[model samples]
Target: MNVKSGSAFFLKVIAILIGIAVLAVCIYWLPAAARRDAIERPGDYSLYPLLVCAYGVCITFSVVLYQVFKLLTNIEKNNAFSELSLHSLKLIKKCAFAVIFFILLAIVYLKVLTQFTGDDPAGPISLGLMGILATSVVAAFMDVLQKPLKNVLDEQLKND
Candidate 1:
């Protein structure tokens, strides 16, 4: 009924979806036509590496969502939004740094794409994008959580 409850439910649903996707890729899709094609093709044979990276990314994304949902529920219970907000801010900062670092690395990889001369460079690019996107989502969630804490802090200061 409340915002926190709704957010928690949404996060659980997302986790489920991510789990399903990972399973589909690992159990169903990868062992079928895609794997066959990758083997038959005369490329870099990076299918296994790509699949592993993708699985890791999906897992990490789901875990982050779960953590944020848990944080929200805890915030609601303890009325300690200020402390959690600060923690979220720290997480946001770290995520931002990670995004920036990945972006730079991806750019360098792209610049040197020609040197690879093995197969398509899309795998690394896609992985980098996924990382950037995941960090962006977490950072945005932190920003959303920060608003209420900011309001509470401001109201407390005004009362004082």
Candidate 2:
């Protein structure tokens, strides 16, 4: 394979490794953390919603990773400037938005629970806001990339 394709392949491998790591954390670490919380708080903690939020975020992560893999494949095929790459970027952006949505929903749920349980929601809310900020940046980057790609595609059409 060529250098560019080799790099793309390396990146794809990295993405797959990241997916596996995230999956391990979600399947093992998250449940273990939940169990710890349960043991500490007994019946007072709301475990299900927390798990739902975590799993929801994990779903988004998988989607984004898949999209990244698609994008890398396009690059490997030397079609990084094609519509498929643009579409993959768009899908990644959507996944980022989904992450933000899930985090926000979790924050709202935790806020409601905190009111009755007397638990401080500041930490989680801050984390959610950070997630929102990160996703917003990703979406903006996708939007920026789309603009240039659209222009190039339009130019290509005009040339033809």
Candidate 3:
């Protein structure tokens, strides 16, 4: 394989590894982490659901990464401007939006928890906000990237 193909292969490997790691974290580490948190703050199981939500978000992220890997594969096969690639980008954008939406929901949940329970939710709230910002940026970038590629695909289709 040429350098470009090698790079794409490497990226695909990395994406697969990331997805595996995320799955491990969600399956093994998350419940443990939540249990630890609960043990540390006895009687406060409120964070449990949030932890589950975080796992859900991680799963979404993993799906998006898989989509990215598929996109890269399409590129390697010289199908970068095809409808499949366009659909992959569209799916990625939607996943990013889902991430943003879920993070925002978590932030609101945290805020409400603080209001009712008087627990200091500052740390988790801030983290959720950061997640929102990061996912928002990803969504925006995907949106920007998709538009031109979509137009190019449209032109290609018309020409064909």
TM-score per candidate: 0.51, 0.88, 0.90
Per-residue lDDT tens digits for candidate 3, residues 78-127, read 99888888899889889988888778778888888889988898898888
Candidate 2: tens digits of C-alpha lDDT, residues 1-160? 8888889989999999999998998999999999899889889668788789899999889989999999888888779889898888888888888888889889999999989889998998998898899889998998898889888988988999
lDDT tens digits, residues 11-130, model 1? 767756776776676678756856686779857554554454445544444455455555656655755656665665556555455554646555455646546765566776676777
- In terms of lDDT, the best-performing candidate is 2
Model 1: runs farther than 4 Å from truth? 1-7, 22-34, 41-56, 75-85, 92-107, 116-160
Q: Model 2 — TM-score against the truth? A: 0.88
Indicate the residue-level lDDT of 122 in model 1: 74
Q: CA lDDT of each candidate? A: 0.62, 0.89, 0.87
**Which stretches of candidate 3 lie above 4 Å from their native place?**
37-44
Candidate 2, position 76, lDDT = 80
Off by over 4 Å in 2: 37-45
Q: How many clashing pairs in candidate 2?
A: 0
Q: Clashing residue pairs, candidate 2?
A: none
lDDT of 2: 0.89
